[model samples]
Target: MNIQLNQKSDKPIYEQLKSEIIRLIMCKELREGESLLSMRALAKDLGISVITTKRAYKELEDLGYINSVPGKGTFVAKGNQTMIREQSLRRLELKIKESIELSRQLSIERSEYADIVEFLWEE
Candidate 1:
């Protein structure tokens, strides 16, 4: 339950919170059925409103990352590797595409780009 909130980020606080939780789940830092700190507790810890944390948790549930019980608490949803892979690949593809576009904008030659990728690939 380690989440960092930045007041100046372009992304909304709830969205940032959602993304960080998802990353933690994908990295196996959060395990299935593991309980999360209560929304009120998290809000107090992060110095944010409880409603904001609720919205973020709601979205995480919507995304199938966690499950909420009526009077209990939120727990990590069971991992589905296929689902995780699809979600993860979508994020990664966008990042790689952005990098490629930036490289092209800088007028880097194709050969130089390929060589650089190859170097990183072996590392």
Candidate 2:
């Protein structure tokens, strides 16, 4: 698993971690039934607190992305990839809405916004 945290971004570090993992899962980089690194392991690797990792993992579990066992480690949940893709796209749409609202507040020109959006899509 690879996560890059932007210290200057407004987004929380944990959320950055969470979103990257979800994207990986949706992209099949983290396949169904693949076991994730334990919370302790991830925290150590990321140099973040265990609490942050736990919170991200908890959210993933609540959203049905992963399953946790008391003795066993957390593993990716198996399901229809189409359904997961739909769910992920929905989340992206909602985030896009938020970004659009912010753009409006900042009085960003439609052309300028489109350019930025195009760059991100290309990336």
Candidate 3:
């Protein structure tokens, strides 16, 4: 798994890490049941505190993207198809919302926006 952190970005370090990990999982780069590095190890690798990594893991666990097994380690959660679909849909919805806002700001016609969406969808 590859994650790049930007200390200069407005986003928090932990949030950036969490988002990259989620993206990896969604892209199947990190498969189900694959073990993740320990919080300390990840923090060291990213040059951040363990607390930041722990928070990211905790949030991922709460979202059902991963789970922790006692005495073992953290692994990607088993198939939660419904949850996964919901997450994917949420991301699509947010993108659509942003597109709508931008189109409105640019005074783009509805039909033109629809054509753009359809064109992208077909690609």
TM-score of each: 0.72, 0.83, 0.74
Better of 1 and 3 by TM-score: 3
TM for candidate 2 is: 0.83
Candidate 2 residue lDDT tens string, 1-123? 877778788999889889888988977899999999999999999999999999999999988899898898999998877887888789889999999999999999889999999999998
lDDT string, candidate 3, 34-111, tens digits: 999999899998899999999999999988899999899999999875778698789789999999999999999999
Candidate 2 segments exceeding 4 Å error: 101-109, 120-123
Stretches of candidate 3 above 4 Å error?
91-123
Among all candidates shown, the one with the greatest lDDT: 3
Candidate 1 Cα misplacement greater than 4 A, ranges:
91-123
- Native-to-model Cα distance after best TM-score fit, residue 37 in candidate 1, in Å: 1.0
User: Which pairs of residues collide in candidate 3?
Assistant: none
Sorted by TM-score (best first), the order is: 2, 3, 1
**What is candidate 2's local distance difference test score?**
0.90
| Residue 98 Cα positional deviation in candidate 2, in Å, after optimal superposition | 3.4
lDDT for each candidate structure: 0.87, 0.90, 0.92
